[model samples]
Target: MTLLICAFAAIIATVKWYKDAPEGNMKLGILCWMYWGASIMWLVDAIFEYAELKAEYFTPAPADMLNDAFLGLAVVALGLIIWLVWLLIKDPRGVVKAALIRKKA
Candidate 1:
């Protein structure tokens, strides 16, 4: 479940990044990299767990699935938060700079 969610997020971010490939302003590429990295990490984890659990891996408990879902959501939310903080620090549109200047006026 976590793998599925992360894979979906990575695909969406990749597509969005491709669409705005010409524009380098928002730094969306970084977000794409983060999500893709997470997806790959989860994929590796799934593979190792499957190897250990074999066929039983297919049938996880409902509670476990719920927990995985929550974790996936949390992971996605954390990625977004990090991206937002980075964007604010970068201030691609100069909004932060303008606000600071206004405060000085």
Candidate 2:
């Protein structure tokens, strides 16, 4: 579940990054990298767990499934939060700088 969720996010971010490639913005690319890395990590985790659980891995408890889903969502949200903080610090479009200048007036 975590692998699937992060893979989807990575795919979406990759597409968006490709679309905006000419603009040279780094944020989308950063997001893509983060999600893809997470997906790969989770894929490895899944593989190891599957090896340990064998056939039983296919039949997770409902509670476990729900918990995995929540964890996946939380990971996605945290990635977004990290991206947002990076964006704010970078201020790529200078919105924050402009706002501060305006405030000085």
Candidate 3:
């Protein structure tokens, strides 16, 4: 089924991101994985929406599909919040600070 294909695609994409993420930026790698998961979720949701639209032109009940999309967005938002909160609370000496310090004149 299409959903199965989508699931496989998502898993492959996530693995690819994990492999390709920059070595020095672990935070960035986590963020990338979060975003990649979200993107794949939305991509699957879009495919569902398109299929529903084509099958039933007048009434495309895409609520389930939209829910998946929102779930993806929520996951990404939650991951970002966790990362930012960690920076504020745990890792005060963040990577951004070092980058900024280097750029200072």
**Candidates' C-alpha lDDT:** 0.89, 0.88, 0.56
Superior candidate under lDDT, 1 versus 2: 1
User: Across residues 4-89, which tens digit of lDDT does each residue of candidate 2 receive?
Assistant: 88899999989999988889665787799899998988899999999999999989999998888888889899999999999989
Per-residue alpha-carbon lDDT of candidate 1 for residues 23-68, written as tens digits (9 for 90 to 100): 7688788788998998888889999999999999989999999999
| Shift of residue 4 alpha carbon in model 3, Å | 22
Clashes of each: 0, 0, 0
- Top model number, lDDT: 1
lDDT comparing candidate 1 with the true structure? 0.89
By TM-score, rank the candidates, best first: 2, 1, 3
Q: Please, what are the lDDT tens digits per residue for candidate 3 over residues 15-92?
A: 765686655333444555655565667567767877777756434358855665565556545766766666555454
lDDT: the better of candidates 1 and 3: 1
Model 2 error, position 81 (Å): 0.4
Report model 3's TM-score to 2 decimal places.
Answer: 0.40
**Model 2 stretches with alpha carbons more than 4 Å out:** 24-26, 103-105
Give all TM-scores, in the order shown: 0.91, 0.91, 0.40
